[model samples]
Target chain A: MDIPSYQDMLAAHERIRPHIRLTPVLQSDHLNALSGARLFFKCENLQEPGAFKVRGATNAVFSLDRDRAAAGVATHSSGNHALCLSYAAGLRGIPCNVVMPHTAPEAKKDAVRRYGGTITECEPSTSSREETFARVQARTGSEFVHPYNDPRVIAGQGTCAKELIEQTGGLDIVTAPIGGGGMISGTCLTLAKLAPDTQVIAAEPEQADDAYRSFKAGQLIADDAPQTVADGLKVPLKDLTWHFVSNHVSDILTVSEQEIVDAMRLGWKYLRLVIEPSSAVPLAAILKNAERFKDKRVGVIITGGNVDLDRLPWTEGA
Target chain B: MDIPSYQDMLAAHERIRPHIRLTPVLQSDHLNALSGARLFFKCENLQEPGAFKVRGATNAVFSLDRDRAAAGVATHSSGNHALCLSYAAGLRGIPCNVVMPHTAPEAKKDAVRRYGGTITECEPSTSSREETFARVQARTGSEFVHPYNDPRVIAGQGTCAKELIEQTGGLDIVTAPIGGGGMISGTCLTLAKLAPDTQVIAAEPEQADDAYRSFKAGQLIADDAPQTVADGLKVPLKDLTWHFVSNHVSDILTVSEQEIVDAMRLGWKYLRLVIEPSSAVPLAAILKNAERFKDKRVGVIITGGNVDLDRLPWTEGA
Candidate 1:
């Protein structure tokens, strides 16, 4: 497989510019005081489909050739990717087929349907998801867009850091939650070329620390459905994402479940942003290791805001 | 009471500029689709004390001369005003004494304390508030800053609309939730001079519709103790606030408790904003009257983000 170059990311930015929002970068003096760091929150929670996934989804959907685009697109995601892919496909007047686990939150499924995606549910397992996805793609003849593994998607995700560099001028450090290493790889991709001095850090839930383990062990590590409140970070890294991670990432930090919940509440309380558990991991890392991030100009990617409101992680019995 | 002129608002803006945030104006396409109106949210929820009340509090605190400023400031509020006043006074290195009903949320009281305000708790009654405020004022020789009825405060709140008009170029209509009528009066004060053609609408909770009733009757109608999920809107209109309401407000609209809760959820879900029940009222009004707002540009003041997370209005059995 060919590695995605900086030029590919630049192209993805141009292609998805009209289709995506240049979400605001917010700063909180209160958060700064608490963390002892100057934090710039890239609020992709404000994205159209309420996550950064739309960047990749839009890039993939819009990059397709006219004839192939006519066949539509397919992806298997339990959350934001499915919703965003549907949104992007709907924007281009194409069909989007989403394969999801039956146990996935109803709110996510409803959002996918709302954005004109057809849902094909499978049993909640990796094998089931892949098998169902293959059958669905074969039956529909849709172009397969892997959530975090595709070069096009990674290039698209890289645009977020590209904007962050331009928006904040430059940063001492950049941090994002690593699920399948999509956003972190994108951050690495952009910072590697544009701002080589900037350190790229990946944060992950301790409950699902595949990326952290993988980075430390110097090899790709796969987790089999690790449970975490940060549902978006449950997936492990692929070879394409692993390549960027191993080459450019500065460090991988892990935070406990309680820390993630605390950070999520802090985002809502102090930053006045509605962010999901996955989005809070970077802040949780900062809180856990204030010494590492102290006094640094840190760009933290708020990955998404697509939690089921009825089942908020901090709620009683949740 | 002296009427607050647009000039006062201009002066207030200049006075408070260094102390307060010029919060971003956010737009949600999902909300626009749902309400059938192009909405520009003036996000005062991002203000220092997490509310637009800081605008008024800062104005009132900073406007005082050296002699009066040294004596400090005092107010009786069960909500955002106390916390914001404390914030303003802290910024100026002065003491702020707050007289709050014991029934006020512990979260609010803690916020006031956190900002260096000394809290004096009273029985949860209007009469108790007045008596306690008088005693505190006499003892401390502090200048009394009325929450919503003071001209300086009205002028301060008006700056939000001033920024909104500039931010959105010019909105066809402006909406704010009416409590003691501070924010609406501020909108009326600014729009009456700056954007006279733009209609100014006041939204109220149906359960505590004193503002709506008072508007139609052309007389101030006080509700002794009105119950509402929007705790901020329970206060009655005073002469200073009523002056602006009666003269400049185009209409008063009210929404049910359920509508307020639903709108709050919609804000959290779609706008990705952490807004309080009171802040949701303007959007709730828009939802309740789609015909009136359809296809028009509307500016909605997101008043505050000070809700108790442990007891969110929509929590199970809340």
Candidate 2:
């Protein structure tokens, strides 16, 4: 994998600027009062298509040649990535075929449909998703936009960090949730070039800490059956993303599911912002290890706000 | 009642600048797409003490003389106002007494306690609340800050519309929820002076449409038994408030309980912001009568985001 540079990230920001929202970097007075850190939240949860997925999806869609673009786009996602790609494709007047699992949330499905995306449901398994996507690609000859593993997507994701640095100067540390590590990889690359002094930390839930274990052990670790409130961080670390993380990121930390739930509730109660469990990963990390980051300037990437409103994490507990 | 002009609102902005947040004006791309009117939300729900009640409370607290302020403050409220006053008083190193009904939500009671407020729980009736507040004031010699009846509070609330107008650049119309008419009075006063072309409309839940009825009948109308999701709009229009609403407010529209529920859910889902039923009134009114404001630049004031998260309005069907 050719690692995208800061120059590439700057270009991605320019490319996706028209399609994506430069979501506000909210300064949390309440959180700051609690932790004694000047925390800036990169609210990607409020981004277009309801996630930072748009940054990557939009970059991928526009990166393709005119003929390839005219041929349309396709992806396999049961979450924000699916909705984002669909929305991005619609903006560009290109067809979007989202192959989602049958068990995908009704809200997510409705969002994709509302954005004018054509959906094809398959079994809720990696093998089934791949097979369904291949079949759809073969039938339509459309380009497949990998959710996180692709270089173009990773470069696009880096644009989030680019904006963060531009908005809040040089940060002491930057943290983001790690699944397949697309967001963190892009974040690392952007920080490595722009503010090398700023430590890039991978915040992973303990239920699915494959990325943390892999980074710590100096080897890729795959989870057969991972579990966590942060559904977006369920995916295992890939080779390309691990390469970026290993080289650029300073450390990786894990937080409990309970901490994630608490952080989500705290965000709503204090920030009045409805953040999904996935978006709460960075906050969970901060709350769990407040000592390490006290009095430092920190930036937390809130990845998305697409939660199952019917079954919130807090209610399931006490 | 002395009418607050745009100049008074400007002064109020300067006075409350240190205490209040210049809450962001957020846009719901999805809602705008669905409703046809380009809707811009003034996010006062994200204000301190978890509501715009702080704006009025803070203004009132600071407007007092140092000697009068040393005597501390007192108010009767079910939740937000009490919490706001307590928080503001705590910040100013002064004492606060809150006269709350025992029937108020546990969360609000907890918040008032968290801010070091002395709670005086009374029966859930106007007579009881008034009697309890007066007794507390007589005993403690604390200054009374009426939630909506105070001109300083109205001036402070009007600063929201002042900020909204500055943020959105003279909206076609400004819609705010009306209870005691503090926010709407401030909004109307600001709009009437600064942007006379911009209409100011009051939104009320049909279950407690005292303000709406009064606006139409040209007389203060208090519902004998008002029942609505919006607990904040339970208060009837006072004489001073009624005068402002009657003179300056363009119209007062009523929305059903279902609309309020739907708007609250939509706010949580789309805007990723936790808004209470009272905050949803403006959005509810917008949905109920979208045809009236079609293709217009509409500004809706989100009154507050404090809600009982354990049992969300979204889960409890309309």
Candidate 3:
């Protein structure tokens, strides 16, 4: 496995610039007062396909040589990455084949289909997802882009943090919610090279704290599945993402399901942002541990906004 | 009433630039495909207090002489204007008093209080609001800033359209949801001078179509307290707003309650914005009457985003 450097990140950024948005950085004085920290929300959620995953997906899709592009691209994701890759592939006039779990949000499934991706449904388990994706990849002979673990994908994701630092000028701390750690790894990769003095905090849901536990134990902990209101954070970190998380992250914080839901509502009311539970994890953690971030200029990465509006966390089982 | 001129709007733009966000203009390819119009959404919903009403309110609050400002500011409103005035007054550290109806959403009422604005509730009728407002003004000696009727407020609202046209370079048509006609009048005011070729269209709910009827009749028509999901657009156009609307507006379009609700959900699903039903009105009108705007660049001002999250239009009575 190769580690992508800052130079690779810069190259990937140029490769994907035409395909992704330089999503705006948002600030809420109301939210800043709530935690005694100035919060700069890097709104990757505003990306046309509604996620930061577009950067990575677009880079991976656009980087393929003409012959490889002709074969198309394939990926297995719980949600956003599948849709984003499909969007990028569609832009490039190529096929995108996605393997998604049966339990994935209906909204994400619809978005993937809207972007012209063909979906193969698998049982809601890691083994099933891997097996299904393998069969699809074998049949199509498409270039496999791992959701977060690929060097090109991580380098592509790094562009978001690079933009965040530039947009805000600088920040004392940068926090992002951790699922498979794609966003966090990207943050670490950028900060370690560009803004070494800045701190990187990874937030996790208490019910699905594999990343948190792994951070404390000094190793990658695997979780096939972990049920949480923050559906995006159910998966565990991959090896390449673990390399960055283990070396560059300053802290790992966890928050309760209720905290996540409360933060989600607060984001909608105060930020007027339609954010998912995963995007709320960093905010929930920040408010929960205010002292650590007090008086600091903090950048909170709003990873995605592809929420299942009908089945919001606050209205579970309604 | 002295009409606010294009020069007055320019002064208001400069006066309120520091206080208001030059809100972003967003475009959605999906929505454009659906409507066959290139829609430029001026996202005033992303304003700090979550509305374009802040533009007028900030101008009104800040324009007062020091001696008059010391007496503070007051207004009667259904929702957005009340909270926005409160937000503006809070910024200047003045006593902001507001007269609101009993039927206003809990969320808006809470926002007014959050900004330290004292709310005096009255029956949800024009007469009751005026009577209640008079009493409050008499007791507090606060300067009256009529939501749309005042020249200062109209001038301030015009800045939104000025920025919208500047941001998009130019548009063939500009559309906004009309309640008391503050936003529409502003669009008309700006375009009549800056972009005379640009047509201004006002959208209204079919259930509360006073503005549409008034446009057709070529005279002011009033709706005392019509019921609609777009709580902000229940009020009638005032004398000052009518001056601009009667002179510059090209057409008035109305949509059904169902159309409004569907557009609101589509905004959430596709735009991923937590927009109020009022903000969805223009989009609904455009889709319902697509042939009129086909292949043309249209600027749609998203009025506000201070929505009652728990009681979304789609989840009513859940």
Candidate 4:
């Protein structure tokens, strides 16, 4: 499998600039005081369709040849990526078919529908998802857009960290949540080329510590039955993602479910920004290990804000 | 009593430029779809202390004499204004006291404390609030900062509109909620001069539409029994505020409690920003009368985002 290089990531940024939003990097005095870190939050949570997934999705959609684009696009995602790809495809005047599991949050499903994507519900299993997506591709003759394994997608996601580095002078450490490891891998790739000394840390929930364990053991591991409030982090580690994580990532830190909830609440109470549990992992990790980040310039990628209001982490304050 | 002219408002913008945040102007496509009008949201909800009240408070704090600043500042408010003044006073190294009504939300009281303000609770009546505040001022020798009536405060409030007009080129109309009319008066003064063709409208909850009735009656009419989810808009219109509303305001529109709640939900669901009912009034009005503003470019001031999480509007959705 061919891996994307630093130059490819830079090229992808240029390719996706028109399709992707250069999301704002917000400075938080309150958050800075909380951890003693001069923190710059790359607010990907506020990106188009409320996630950084749009960057990769836009890049993938736009990179396709006119003939391929005309054939349409297909993907399987339970959350932000599905909606993002659908939205990006719709913008490019192409049809999108998303194979979302039945267990996916209603809010996400609604967003995908709103973006004019045809949805096919599958059982909550990788085999089921793959089989269903293949059927979708066969039925519609659409090109399958891999969520993260694809080099173009990884390079596209790297643009977020590129913008972060440009927006802030330089970050001492960059932290992002690792699920399928797309965001973190992209972030690490950008940081490696732009500022090699800057640490690239992957934050993951303890319940779903596949990336964390894999990084520590130097071998890919999959969390078969991950249990966490962060539904987005349930996807198991992939080989390409593991390769990116093993080399470029400096460390992987695990945060508790309670910590994720606390971070989400803090984002809402202090930042006045709604963030999903998956996005909270990095913040939770920072707060848990304040000593590691104190007096340093840290960048946190707020992955997404597509939270289900019904199942919100209201239990924290309760 | 001297009313703030458009010129005075511009001068206020100059005065507070160094101290206050020129808050972000965000366009909501989802709201535009629902409202018919292309809605530009001036996000004062993300302002310092999470409300537009900080604009006036900061101006008041900075404008005070050295002697007056040393003596300190005091006010009575149910929430945002008191906390805003407390924060502004804290910045200037001055003592801040808030004589809040006993009925004020705990979240509001907590915010005041977080900003380092001493709270003195009084009975939930105007006479009681005035009497308590007067006693506190007499005992502490702190300059009393009225929530809305003061000219300096009005000037500070006007700066928001001035900034909004500057950010949005020239809006066809500007809408803000009217409680004691501090923000609306400032908004009208700024728009009436800078964007003369811009319609300056006030959105009030139908349950607490004293300003709407008074606008029509051409006389000051207080709500004998005000009831609305928007706690900030319960106050009666003051003399100085009435003068501006009577003269410069194009019209006052009323929105139902349901509409206010729905608008607040939409703010969270679509914009992914938490907004208080008061902030949602303009949006509520827009949603209710989409035809009235067809093709018009509308500027809506989202006043605050300080709602209690325990009592989130999503509970109703559940």
Best by TM-score: 3
Cα deviation at A207, candidate 4, in Å, is 0.6
Error of 4 at B176 (Å): 1.2
The RMSD of every model to the true structure, in order and in angstroms, is: 1.3, 1.7, 1.1, 1.9
What tens digits encode model 3's per-residue C-alpha lDDT throughout B1-318?
889899989999999999888777887888999999999998898899999999999999889999999999999999999999999999999999999999999999999999999999999999999999999999999999998888888889999999998899999999999999999888888889999999999999999999999889999988888999999999999888888889999999999999999999888877778899999999999999999999999999998999888788787765
**In candidate 4, which residue pairs clash?**
none
lDDT of 3 at B107: 96
2 or 3, greater by lDDT: 3
Proportion of native contacts found in each model?
0.67, 0.69, 0.64, 0.40
TM-score winner between candidates 3 and 4 = 3
A136-229 per-residue lDDT for model 3 (tens digits): 9999999999989898889999999999999999999999999998889888989998999999999999999989999999988888878887
DockQ (0 to 1) for model 4: 0.55
Q: Model 2: runs farther than 4 Å from truth?
A: none
Task: For residues A103-174, write the lDDT of model 1, one tens digit per residue.
Answer: 887878999999999999998767788999999999999999999999889999999999998999999999
State the local distance difference test value for candidate 2: 0.86
Assess the local accuracy of residue A64 in candidate 1 as a C-alpha lDDT between 0 and 100.
Answer: 96
* DockQ values, each candidate: 0.74, 0.68, 0.77, 0.55
| Model 3 accuracy (lDDT, Cα) | 0.92
The superposed Cα distance between candidate 4 and the true structure at residue A218, in angstroms, equals 1.1
Cα lDDT of model 4 by residue, A79-190, tens digit: 8899999998988999999998898889899999999999999987778888999999999999888888778889889999999889888989999998998888888778
How do the candidates rank by lDDT, highest first? 1, 3, 4, 2
Error of 1 at B140 (Å): 0.8
